[model samples]
Structures are given as structure tokens and as C-alpha cells.
Target: MVDTGSANRRDDRTPVLAVAGIGKSYAEGKQRRTVLADIGFEVARGECVALVGQSGSGKSTLLNLLAGIDKPDTGDVEIMGRSIAAMGEPELTLLRREHIGFIYQFFNLIPTLTVAENLALPLELNRIPSAVRRQRIGDWLAKVGLDGREGAFPDELSGGEQQRVAIARAIIHEPALVLADEPTGNLDGRTGNVVLQLLAHLFRDQGRTLILVTHSRAVSEVADRILALDNGRLTHDTEALSW
Candidate 1:
């Protein structure tokens, strides 16, 4: 793996992510519609935060901003103490490649690539040595309980298995932060619970910080803290309030 050096120098007391006075809106012909208003939060190292919101409550938008996938109209988003809005496109791309990992609801594995290849993509991008990459691929496959399925394609696996591969892929590169969007939404209830349990265990064991966007109360309950969004506003939810 490429030695970014930043992680080693980071203080554990510093938050992995910080967002301040963030706001976003979209132009709708002659008018603009606000999606998020004055949104703000901090996620410390190894903390898992769940973002719960209604369909249009802007949970995805907030996540996009945090990932630097999209920019907010106002305020700032900082990851590892660097402002995302201050980075150029190339810098943002590099930031994402080196610092952020993403998990999607649909198990966004490449249909054409084998499981090993899929897991190796991030390591390859980060210029990890081929030997180490192979070892990590084997190791993560075992961690996610997908051993011996290295040559299998995405379509060949069950939903839970595919998601397990996705989870391993997201984390194998050892990113500082992980963004999960409805990670278990595509699976059956029993399978989803099992996957969730595995995800929580692996992340906690590795001490990786996570911000998950989920609609299910059961899913959100796994997080250390839950933040609720409604009508473009955010609130800390101790009760894990339902929409």
C-alpha cells in the first residue's frame, strides 16, 4: 500500500470527519429548492454514526458532500482536517481514492470481474505491491466469509454473498472513513441481520470510522450515535426516531 503518511501522524482525539454549517440546494427552473440547511456534525476515529432520514430528507446529499462526491452550496466539509471544498477535482479524486471507502445498497460489484479482482481494485489503485495485494485479497475473502469464491462473478453469488464481497472490497484498502448507503437494504431480513453483524464486527475490530445511511431502525441501532434529518434540518436522535 502507498504510504500516505498522514494517517500515522493523525491524533486519535481528532475527529475523522467534521462538517460545519453545510447547506445545499438545486435550481428548479426559475426557483431553487433547498435539500440540506445548516447541517453539521463530527465523527471521531472508530466511531460509527447512522444517518436516518425520510426519502427526500437529504441523507444521500449529506453523504455525498461528506465524501466529496458533490459540493455543498455553503459551509465546509473536512476529512482528516482537510477541507473538501478547497480541493480541486484531481485532489478530490485522490482524497477519495486514498481516504474514503464506499459501500452501496445494491452490492455494487463489477459483474465482469471475479471476486478476487473486485477486491483487488482499490489496492491496485493505491499501488499496493502485487504480492501484498494477493495476500490481502485472500485475507479479506476469509474475513468476509467468502473463501474459495475468488473466481466467482457477482451474478453467480447470492445477495448476501455479493454484499460480503462488497464489504471486503470497501475495507481492504484500509481507508480512514467508510460511507455505507443502505448496506443491507437489498437482502432478506435474516441475511441482512447477519451481514450487518459481520460488518459491525469487522469494522470495530479494525477500528475504522463509519457513517451509514440507512432507513431501518434495526440497522441504525448498531451505530454508536444516530442523527435524524427532516425537512432539511438535522437533530441528534437518542431514541432512533422513525420517520
Candidate 2:
């Protein structure tokens, strides 16, 4: 039997992710425009949090800060109790490679690589043995319902199939956190729902933490908590408001 108990096994004292007083800005012309300001929150291990905002609301910027892909002008992002601000480039790269997974709206699969090759990228980067990597690739392909299509390239698959491969690629390394940016934005309603269900199943069943950024209310509802961003500031936290 699968171990459902894994969900309850996390230590409640230390959150998987913490953000404090984060601020970011960009130079537009002569003046700087703020994208995010003083954003702070924490996501507990095994919890799924949705970040909701309208277009140009800085949701994507925040996700980048969380992933160490971009730096905040002020404040710190702590993942698994370590501050990302203190890490240099190499350390940050390693941190991302080891602890963070990302799913993008574009299904960012390499056009040249087959589905299995794309799935195998993370495992290879982390130096998982070739023998074990093959097993994991096989297992995840089956899990995502793309088992026999491993040889297919990205262009050969439908939108949903490509997304399934992306999801499998994101989680196959067992990263401590997953950040999804508009995961369903590129699909139709029915396909999006299927992807969401697949994500919910994999993350919840494995006791993984997810921070999903979306504009859709229906998509936000999938999370255990919702955080709403408005005009560069955090306007609502469902956990804080007890909604």
C-alpha cells in the first residue's frame, strides 16, 4: 500500500518556505517601477498555496524570487530554512537543481529531446546513476500516463500530453518545493482540469509542497490556502483571514 502517512510526517516547527519583506523593482525609463513590495509569508511543508493576481500583478516575479531565478532588491527568501540571498551563483544553481521544481505555462520542453530525454534531464543533472535513472524515468512515465510514448518528441504530443511530461519532469527529482506559473493557462478547460487533478494527486500523495501562481479562481481553489496580490502588495492571505 502507498504510504498516506507521509503527509503527516513533516515537522511543524519549520516551514518549507518563508518570505520576508521582499521588494523588487525594474527600471522602466527614467524611474524605477516597483513590481513587488514588502511581501511576506510562509508555506508549511506538505501544504499547497495558491498565489492569485491579475495580469501584471507581479505574481511571476515573486515566483522567480522564490526559485532563485531572480533576486529581490530587498529582503530574503528562505527555502528549507536557508536564505537564498546568501547563496552565490553556483550555490544557488545547486540549490535550485536539488530543491526546487518549476512548471511553466509554455510547457518549456526542449524541441530536440524526446519525452524520456526531457524527463531524464533532472535526474542526470543531479547525478542519479544511469541504472536508477532509467527505472525512475519508467516509473514517472507510467505515473503521468505517458508510459509508451517515451520515444515521442514534444511536437508529436498533444497539449495535455506535453504538460504531463512537464509535470513528470518537474517532480521526478523529488524536489522539496514546486513552483507552478499559470500551469493551466495554455490548455482548454477540460485539459486544464485533468492537469490539475494529476498535479493534486502527485503532490498530495507524496506529501510535497506547491506554490502555484494563477489568475483563475477555479485554479486557485485547488490550493489549501490562497494569497492574493494586488498592485505589488499582498492584499489577502486566506490563512491569516481564516477564510
lDDT of 2 at 50: 92
The local distance difference test score of each candidate is 0.92, 0.92
Location of the lowest summed lDDT over 10 successive residues in candidate 2: 4-13
- Cα lDDT of model 2 by residue, 52-151, tens digit: 8888999999999999989999999999989999889999999999999999999999999999999999999999999999999999999999979989
TM-score of 2: 0.93
Please identify model 2 stretches exceeding 4 Å from their true place.
1-12, 239-243
Per-candidate TM-score against the hidden true structure: 0.94, 0.93
How far out, in Å, is residue 216 in model 2? 0.9
